[model samples]
Target: MVVVGAGLSGIAAAHYLRSECPQERFVILEGRDAIGGTWDLFRYPGIRSDSDMFTLGYTFRPWTSDAAIADGAAIRDYIRATAREEGVLPQIRFGHRVTSANWDPATARWNVEAEREGQALRLTCRFLFFCSGYYDYEQGYDPAWPGRESFAGRIVHPQHWPADLDYANQQVVVIGSGATAITLLPSLAAKAAHVTMLQRSPSYIIALPARDAIGRALQAVLPRKAAYRLIRWKNILLSSALFQFSRRRPAAMRNWLVRQAQARFGPTVQQRDLQPRYDPWDQRLCIAPDADVFRAVHSGRASIVTEQVARFVPQGVELASGRVLPADLVVTATGLKLKLLGGARITIDGQPLQVTDALSYKGMMLSGLPNLAMAMGYTNASWTLKCELIARQVCRMLNHIRRQGLDVCVPVLDTDAGQTRPALDLSSGYIQRASGELPRQGSRKPWRIYQNYLLDLFSLNLAPLRDGALRFARRGETPR
Candidate 1:
């Protein structure tokens, strides 16, 4: 088996594979020289998990930290610690980026090619697991604005923050209302003379305490393992309920969210910037830990400006509303560009695999794709909540294949059985931007990907492996 990536998903895959299939030989190929993929790469101000650590942490290992929302360094260290303690670190090949993979039906193995230190390398594996996340790492989504070259001030994207860049007592403007923008507001405001969050549209912002009060209290009375399990389930159930409530009663959810925001940021900020045009959960809600962003706004260190950008001038950005915002630095917390399967070229039996033409099977494996699985997380909840479930299901399928003496397994999509829909149901900018590039999901069971945790728990973890859509075959016997 070959696992691509060393990030949270990759680590989870490695941990599960080692525990379930101890006899199987596997290697984790990481493109970067670090163990933590996103956590190690992103080094901007106030980098932390958008989801609580209870769900984000591995199922096998409990998150002992008191912080519900952990910082980038802390998450990175947690991943490294897991790798070291679980003996997966020695199996990792850092700086090895998978370039292409070709599947041979005759051999029932994949000829994987990777680039390491400017040299090409090859390896063969019976099963290919794609743990590489669905985003471009080198470059984030930064659209070209008119007169961009005319701006003399420093412009930095959060994905590529400079090491020695200083903004103390300098005017700064952030150009987005997403999670990154919300996180950056207070962190930048601490040192900068003033920080401005300029957005064309508002986003629902909810205030969550930095520490988990209930979790901490539970730990005091219950055993460590028991407390962890309790908190994990609590978060999972609460998140699931909230998501369902948002869909069932969007107006109520919207009103409740607005009231929460108004209470933290007061009516002025709520009316001017916090109240989004769309209903709650239209896009993923941004979580503000300890109301820091609101505190910054109230303290006059940070302010919100709602307007469209006209263009960049010599010193700063010019608004479409005929107003100019002066700034010594501009941070484009724009977004990420999607790159499925780590942007690797895939060919089966010398035939190129068109990902867009394929339908998603159980949101983990692609249609007509054999012995391959991708760990994609929930859009509504913590990412690892879905990823851990995917790992378990993949392990179960692998074991089933071994027991049945099957050489390969692939999902067969029958168009007549179900209707096709967009891969993701979310209206987020990032998801919509890459909708055409991603695989489609079917309307029926197993084919459709549900955002609800409880629904996915039954569908992904409990469903039988021998579903009608899945085709199994022996070596040298390809299913037609």
Candidate 2:
């Protein structure tokens, strides 16, 4: 077996592989020299998880920190500690970026090719598991705004933030309306002369308490794992309820969210800058821990501009309305680019297989692909929640194959009167941009991807193995 990343998802996959598939041996391949994945890659100011750490943390390992929204450094340390504790550190091969993977049907093995530095390395495994995230590690999604090359101020993308670039007392402009921009506003305002969040339109932003009072109280009274389990369920239920409410009653949820933000931002904030054109959960909601962003805006340290960028001026950005805002530094807090399989070229029996050409099987395995699984998380909740479920399911499948003397397992895509839908339900800018690249989902069970945790838990975690969608076969025989 082979795991494609050594990040949070990969690490979780490793733990499950070791615990459930004990008879199998596997190796973890990481593209970077570090282990934390997103936590290690992102080095911008106030880099933290949008979701609470309790739910984001692994199911086996309980998160002990009082801070629900943990910083990047702490999260990185936690991942490292988890890996070390689980004995997964030594299995990681750093600087080995997988470039191509070809599965041979005759031998039921995957011939994987990767690059380390300037040299090429190859390996073979029975099963290929891709735990690498969806984001493109090479670069973020930065639009080629006009006059960008003519700008005199320093332009930086948050994905590749400079280590020594200081913004002390310098006016900074962050361009985007997503979570990155929302997080940067409060953090940069602390040191910058003035910070402005320039967005074309508003996004639903909510403030969650950094400290979990109920969790703390529960932990103090109950046993270790028991308390953690209770809090995790509580969070899962609340988050799921909120998402369902937003989808069922968009207007009521929008008004309630606006009122929540207003209560934090005080009476002076304008609705144009706070309320989004779309309903809550249309795109994933941005979180402002402890109302920090609203406090910064209320204190006059940061401001919001709801306008489209026409071009870049010598000193700053020129708006569509001919308004020019001065800035010493420009941080493009634009969203990430979706890169599936870590930009690897996949082939089956020497034939090419693009991700877009296949359908996602239960959001893990792809249709017509043998002995492969991907670790993708939930958009509406903590990413780790869905990733953990995927890891567990992969382990279950591995055990089933070993017990039944099967060599391969693949999900068969079922068509419903030739109808199909996009895999993701979000109407976010990034998702819409990558519509052509992402796969489609089936209309019914074992093919449809329900973002709800409860649904996924029942299907992937507790459901029977023989679902009629996931097919199995021997090495020489074709998957039924």
- The lDDT values for all models are 0.90, 0.91
Off by over 4 Å in 1: 270-272, 415-417
- Give lDDT tens digits, candidate 1, residues 1-480: 999999999999999999998777899999999999999999999999999999999989899977999999999999999999999988999999999999999899999999999999999998999999899998999989898899989999999999999999999999999999999999999999999999889899888989999999999999999999999999999988888899999999998987888787775474766678887777889999999989999999999999999999998999998799999999999899999999999999989999889988888998888889999998889999889889988888888789888889888876454788777777878878998888998888778888877888888889777778888899788653
Measured over all alpha carbons after superposition, the RMSD of each candidate to the real structure, in angstroms, is: 1.3, 1.2
What TM-scores do the predictions have? 0.98, 0.98
Over 1-480, each residue of candidate 2 has an lDDT whose tens digit, in order, gives 989999999999999988988888999999999999999999999999999999999998999877899999999999999999999888999999999999999999999999999899999999999999887999999999999998998999999999999999999999998999988999999999999999988888888899999999999999989999999999999999999999999999999988888778776567778889898898989999988999999989898888999999898999999999999999999889888899999999999997777888888888889888999999999989999999999999889999999999988765441456778768888788889988887777777888999999999999998888788899898777
The clash numbers for all candidates, in the given order, read 0, 0
Model 2 RMSD in angstroms: 1.2
In angstroms, the error of model 2 at 139 is 0.2
Clashing pairs in 2: none
State how far residue 126 of model 1 sits from its true place (Å): 1.1
Residue 58, model 1, lDDT: 92
Residue 328 accuracy (lDDT) in model 1: 93
